[model samples]
Every structure is written in C-alpha cells, then in structure tokens.
Target: METIVPNWPAPARVRALSTTRDGGLSQGAFAGLNLGAHVGDEAALVEANRGLLQQAAGIPGRLNWLNQVHGIAVHPVSNEYDGAPEADAACAHEAGLACIVMTADCLPVLLCDRAGTLVAAAHAGWRGLQNGVLEASIKAMGCKPAEILAWLGPAIGPSAFEVGGEVRDAFLAEQAEAVAAFIPSANEGKWLADIYQLARLRLARAGVSAVYGGEHCTFSDRERFYSYRRDGQTGRMASLIWLAE
Candidate 1:
C-alpha cells in the first residue's frame, strides 16, 4: 500500500499520511485502498482495505473517522466516542487515536502544533472552505494559529475545478482577494477555481502561515487518486493525522 506522507517539519511524535487509490482488495471503480464506507463499495471490501491500511501504514491505533457533511462542524476525537460524529473536521490531543477525514476530490487539511501534542484533520470542499472549516479546525486545536502547521492534502486542482459565477461570487463576498484564485474558463459564466490557493488564503487569514502539500491534482491523476468529478461512482481515500502514543 503506497501512502503519501506529509513532508513538513512536524515534531517527532506527530505523524500524518494521505492514502492513495492503491493497494487494497477493492476492484472496478472502487479499486485500490478505498477506505470510505459511504461510497457504495461493498462493506467487506472497504473493511478489508482498511485492514490493509492499518497493517501497511502501521497506524498507531483506531482512526476516529467523521461522518462528513461538507459543513464547518469540527469535532474533538477520542476512543470513547460512540460513533463517527456528523462533522467535517476532527482533532485529537490524545495519543494513539487518529483524526481522519475521507475525500475523493474535496480538500483535506491536516494540522498539528509544533509541540506535537495536538493534531487535526479537516474536510474542506468549496462550501466548507468559504464557510470556515479550516478556521474551525484551528479554533479546535486550542493553540495559537501561528503555532500550528498545516499540510494541504490531495484535491481537485485549479485547472479542472470549473465552477459557475455564483461560486466565485460567494468566495468574493468573503474576501476580495479570492478573485485571484479564479480564472475565466472557456465556457461562458464559468471559472476554474484554484482550491489550493483558496485554502491558503483562508489559512492565511486565520494566521496559519506554515502550510505544505498542495501539489496533488486528484481529477487529473486517475491512477493515484479517486476523483469523484472524474469518476461519478468512485472510492474515497483517507487523510489522517495523530500524535504517537
């Protein structure tokens, strides 16, 4: 199982990895390490792929997965939680418990304090991004935003993420600087939005300056990623972060 580890300068005890669409029991549209349970793949196959992930990646303990709704809700995670909460972001201060988010095209932002005592993961689609999911995650960390380091995981990149004028207008309503992130697409009344740049702008406003890992283009990379825009019915990859026990 090939996993993309964040290349930032995190502390020794802090670990983060983004899974790809590779190395699993799933076949066809959901082939290769599909860890998401809600994407219509067979339950047993998803479970088996998760097992492969745990074994191959050596995750410290159980992952605290979220039932993401593409909203700005952020939850604190622990082993005692009953089930995945209805949230788009999760954080963990306790060791041995990972905070995870599943995504095919939506952006996953993984955060950790310099001390390695806190870790968080956020699922940010354009709506969540505009509505403050990353900000909510920074607030949940209980640390100064400047002290947090973020790694922007794989998502649909700028060139392929076409949107209507309303989508661009929504971001502009929040921050005028957002205009730079949108470029006129060939189609009239449409624009290609740069999800990575938009994320950076939001993080910058929230005071998270040390950001990394936003080079991936899920829509373009069919072999390594699962892009919902590229494949209507597809699997989901997981981006996870945790403090070592």
Candidate 2:
C-alpha cells in the first residue's frame, strides 16, 4: 500500500503518514483505500482496507478511531479504549499507539512535538477549525505550542471551496485574522475559503511556528484522493501519526 509521508522537519522517530484513495478493495464510491467504517462502506471491506493500512504503516496496535463530532473535543488515546472514541482529535505519547483522523475534503492536521514524545491528529472541518479544534489538540498533547510541529493534510483547495456569507462570518466572528483566508468569489455574498491558510493562522495564534505540508487538493485530485465535495457519496482517507517503537 502507498502512503504520503508528511514533508516536514520532524524528528526521525516521529513517524507520520497520510493515506490516499488507492490500494484497497472497496468498490464504487468507496473505491480504493476507504478506511472509514462510518461512511456506509461494507463492514468487511472497511476492515480489509484498515488492515492493509496497518500492515503498510507497520503499526502493531489498533488505530485510535474517533467519532469526529466536528467540535473542539480532544482525547488522549491508549490501548485501553477498545472501540472508537467520541472526539474530534486524539493524542498519544505511547510508542505503539497511533492517533488517527479520517477525512475526505475536510482538513486533517497532524501534530507532533520536536522531541517525538507526543503526536496528535485532528479532524478540522470549518466548524471544528473555527471552534478551536487545533488549539484543543495542541493543549491535549501537554507540550508547549512552540515545541510542536504540524503538517496540514489533503483537503478542498481554495479554488474549489466556495462558501456562503454565513460560513465566512462564522470564522470572522471567532478570529478577526480569519478574514485574510477568504477571497471574494464571483457569486454575490460568497467567498472562496482557503482552509490551509485558516489552519496556519489558527496554528500561529496557538504559538506553533513550525507548520508545513499544505499543497494537496482533494477536490481536484480525483486519482489520488477521495473528495466529499466533488462526489456526494465518497470514501474517506486517513492522516495518522505516532512515535516509533
């Protein structure tokens, strides 16, 4: 199975990967490498895809899945949680444990400290990002924000992510700096939102200076990734990070 290694200056022991929509057995809308079982894909097929991902990553432990309510909830993951946790982000300091977040077009932000002791993955849709999801994830890591490194995973690019006035106002209401992330669209009362820029602004506000990896465009890249905006019923890809054993 192929995976995208985050292009950041993180430590050697801080292993991280983001999966695309390739190398899986799911058919139709949930084509190659659909790792999310909550997306209506067959249970067996989803399991098979996840198994393939685990083998590729060489992670000995189960991936910590979250319910992803698109809120600011962050949870600490360990082996004790046998099933999915109801949170938007997860952090792990354990060697074998992996913190993972699934997404299609929404932003998946992966975080790790310079020392490689803590790692986290956050599902940052517009709601979550505006509601302090990244901040919460960083806080959950229990490390100073300055020592943390972040990588922005695949999501809907600015050109394709047109939003209504209300969506733009929601972010502006929380942080005035968010206004820079939106560009006026041709449609009246609409704007083209740059999710990567918004994430960078949020991370910067939280004091994380070392951020990278925001070139991926899920909506346009049909061959490499699945996009919920491009296709209504689509599969989900995952962004994962963990400390190496």
Candidate 3:
C-alpha cells in the first residue's frame, strides 16, 4: 500500500503517515486503500482494506478511528476510549495507541511534542478550520503550544480550493490577516483559499511555531488522492499518528 510519510521534525518515536488511493482490496471509485468505512464503500471491502493497511503499515495497536463530523470536537484516545467516536480530531499520549482520521479533500493535521510524549491527528475542512479544530487538538495534547510540532497533511490546495464570499468573510471576521490567504478566483465573489496557510495562521495564534508538510494537493492529484470535490463519490484515505513503544 502506498503511503505518504510526513516529513517533519518529530521525535523518532512519533510515527505518522497519510495513505493515498493506492494498494487496497476495494474496486471502482473506492479502489486502492479506501480505509473509511462510512463513505458508502461495502463493509466487507472496507474491513479488508483496513486489514491490508494494518498489515502493510505494521501499526503497533488498534487504530483509534473517528467518525469525523467536520467539527472542532477533539477526542482523547486511551484504553477507555473504545470504538469510533464522533469527532474531527484525536490525540494520544500513550505508546502504541494510534490516533487516526480519514479524509479526502479536508486537511489532516498531525502533531507531536518535541519529546514524543504525545501525538495527534485532526480532520480540518474549511468549517473545521474556522471552528478551531487545530486549536482544540493542540489543547488536547496537554502540552504548551510552543513545545508541540505539527504537520499539515494532504488537502485541497489553494489553487484548487475555490470558495464563496461567505467563506472568505467568515475567516476575515475572525482574523483580518486571513484575507491574505484568499485570492479572487475567476468566479466573481468567489476566492481561491490557501487552507494550509490558514491553518498555519491559526496554529501560530495558539503559539505553535514549528510546522511542516503542506505541499500536497488532493484536488489536483487525481491518481494518487481521492478528492470529494473532484469526484462526488470518492474514497477516503487515512492519516494516522502514534507513539512507539
């Protein structure tokens, strides 16, 4: 199974990767490593693909998956947190506990402290970003923002993420500097947004300065990624992080 290992300055024990639409058991639009079970893929095929991911990635423990709602709700992963919780972000301080989130066009932010005592993954669509998912995830880490490192995973790039005026206005209402991240698109009253930069702005506000991995463009990379905007009925890829034992 093909996966994009996040290239960040995390500690050696922090393991994280974003899976691509490659190497799995599903067929058609959900073909090649479609790890999300709720995206309308057959239950059996999704389960089998998840197994393939576990075997290929060699995850140390069961992945703590989330039923993402594109909100800012942050779920803390531990022995007590069993089954998929309805949240957009997850964090874990325990070794071998994998915090996972599935996405296609939404940005996945993976985080860890400098000492590798904590790890987190967040699903940030435009709404989640505006609602402070990254901030909540950072808060859930139970570490000072300055001590945490973050990676902005694959998402719809600025060039491809066109949005209506309300989207731009909503962000600008929160922070005027957000205006810089939006450029007028071909469609009047619409703008192309740089979600990666917007996320960086939010993280910086919360005192997180060390960030990386915002170069991927899911909307443009059809062969490697599954874009919800590009393909209405597409698959979902998993972005996960965990602390090694």
What is residue 187's positional error in candidate 2, in angstroms? 1.7
lDDT of 3 by residue, 1-245 (tens): 78999888899999989899988888988878888888888999998888888877787677677888989898988877677889999988888888888999999999999999999999999999998999999988999999999998999999999999999999999989998899999998899999999999999999999999999999999999999999999899999998888
- lDDT accuracy of residue 69 in candidate 1: 95
Where is the poorest 10-residue window by lDDT in model 1?
Answer: 55-64
TM-score for each predicted model, relative to the true structure = 0.98, 0.98, 0.98
What is the C-alpha local distance difference test score of candidate 2? Answer: 0.93
Candidate 3 overall lDDT versus native: 0.91
Give every collision pair in model 3: none
Q: Model 2 over residues 15-133: C-alpha lDDT tens digits? A: 99999998999999998999988888999999999999999999998878888889889989888987887899999999988999999999999999998898999999999998899
Tens-digit lDDT string for candidate 1 (1-245): 88899999999999889999988989999988899899889999998988888777677677677899999998989778787799999999998788889999999999999999999999999999999999999999999999999999999999999999999999999999999999999999999999999999999999999999899999999999999999999999999988877
Candidate 2's displacement at residue 18, Å, is 0.4
Q: Which stretches of candidate 1 lie over 4 Å from their true place?
A: none
Alpha-carbon runs more than 4 Å astray in model 2: none
Backbone clashes counted, model 3? 0
For candidate 2, the clash count comes to 0
Worst 10 residues of 2 by lDDT: 60-69
